[model samples]
Target: MTPDEVIAAWDQPGATASIHPTRGISEGAYWASGEAQAALLAQDIPAGSRVMDFGCGDGRVAIPLRALGYDVTGVDASPNMLAALNRHAPDLATFRSDGSDFGKHLGRRKFDAVYCLAVLIHHSHETGQQLVERLRAVVRKGGILVLDWPVADEPAETNAWIGVTTWSRDQQDQITKRLGLTRLDVDRPWAVYQA
Candidate 1:
């Protein structure tokens, strides 16, 4: 999807607005800092990892990652969302950029990890494939990619992946292969990739 398409559809209303029905989503948004720490704790996510949260809303991950002392930067298209995030995480640094073009905000700061949780699913799988390419470029070699979204062909109105396109196992394998990444097991809610 082009920037305009993203802005019009998802960024404006096409993307996952927020996780509803999931009690955790509410808790995380309210206490983003703690939620980040708890979520990362279960994973192999390292301390001091340079992290980027694409489409970070209210710093649900960004705030906690920051609290953990990871060099974190968040990018989102909504000023309202960013403002809400800033309110909770005042020290948080953010940039208003669409997911399609994060280069200007990123500059030369390649991250140790790049995450687009349910963010890429806003577009079609073909577009998601392109995003895999773009996102891979933002991370240093050997970095991790935390790609998350529900696996299905169609989008779900209540869930994050609803109405959005997604990858089949074969599609995922092919794209990761081209990027020189190895699939590390799907962690239910999120897909893990190691470059």
Candidate 2:
């Protein structure tokens, strides 16, 4: 799906489950997962560093990351998702985007790291590549980017909003090279790249 389509889909009711279906089964489990992810992010991004939680839905990860001492900002295309996040962490910063003009949203600003979980898998290959490139652009050189971009034996593109897109190792490597990203050897589910 294109970024605009994804944004529209996310704005509809009951879209949080599309972000993480099983995690939303219980509120305890849902927020616990965020804390766990925040812990993993903390290992790479130093405490108190400025960070952006791209595709952050309802402060699930952003809230916990902020509690861990990072100045975390939530960026999402859906106003409903952002509204839900604001309800929980009213003070946490947020930016509305459709993945087109991120630079305009952060004029003269850059983050130490950015993490985009459960986002790229929902986009087509071309859209996913563009999203990754845009994400890389918002971070400073040597900054970190953690993405839930998966790899499979056969590369595939997602046609639905809730579908998964997988890339081959060679394809991932090529994007890493093209984006000047140095893959980090991290013990996490998501791939960690250095800008």
Candidate 3:
């Protein structure tokens, strides 16, 4: 799906699963999963660091990360999602974008770390790569990026909005090299890399 299509699907009512699979189980489970993700991120992200929660759907992980002492700015493509986040966390800084135009929202600022979860898999490889490059541009040199990009034995790109896209090991490796991302040895579900 293109970024606009992904945004449309997520903005629709009853599309909670597109934002998070755990939402289909229970509200408690969904929020708990976000807490778990925040906890994992806290393990690596330094306290008081400026962080960007890319694809921050309704401040799920972003809220908990703020509680953990990180200065988090939420960014998302969907206006409804940002509005929902505003209702939930009115004080948290947020930017509306389809994984582009950071400077328009943030000016010349840069983040210490960025985490993108449940976002990239919905896009095509070329679009995902473009998004990644744009994300990398907003981070300072040596800043960390915790991404949900996955690799599978048999790589595939899902056509559905909520489908998972997996890359081959070689494909991942090549992108890592091209992006100048050094893979980190981290005990986390998402791929950790340093720019």
Q: Candidates' TM-scores?
A: 0.77, 0.96, 0.95
Could you give candidate 1's per-residue lDDT for residues 11-79 as a string of tens digits? 355233443334345664546544653375337557788787877876767776676677778877767
Best by lDDT: 2
TM-score of 1: 0.77
Q: Model 2, poorest ten-residue lDDT window?
A: 15-24
The order of the candidates by lDDT, greatest first, is 2, 3, 1
Ranking by TM-score: 2, 3, 1
Error of 2 at 25 (Å): 2.9
User: 94-191 in candidate 3: lDDT tens per residue?
Assistant: 98998678888878888999999988888988888888888888888889888898888988887888798887768877887888888898878888
Q: Candidate 1 — worst ten consecutive residues by lDDT sum? A: 154-163
Instruction: Please give the CA lDDT of all the candidate structures.
Output: 0.67, 0.88, 0.87
lDDT of 1: 0.67
Q: Which is the winner by lDDT between candidate 1 and candidate 3?
A: 3
Q: Candidate 1 — which residues are off by over 4 angstroms?
A: 1-6, 9-19, 23-38, 153-162, 186-188
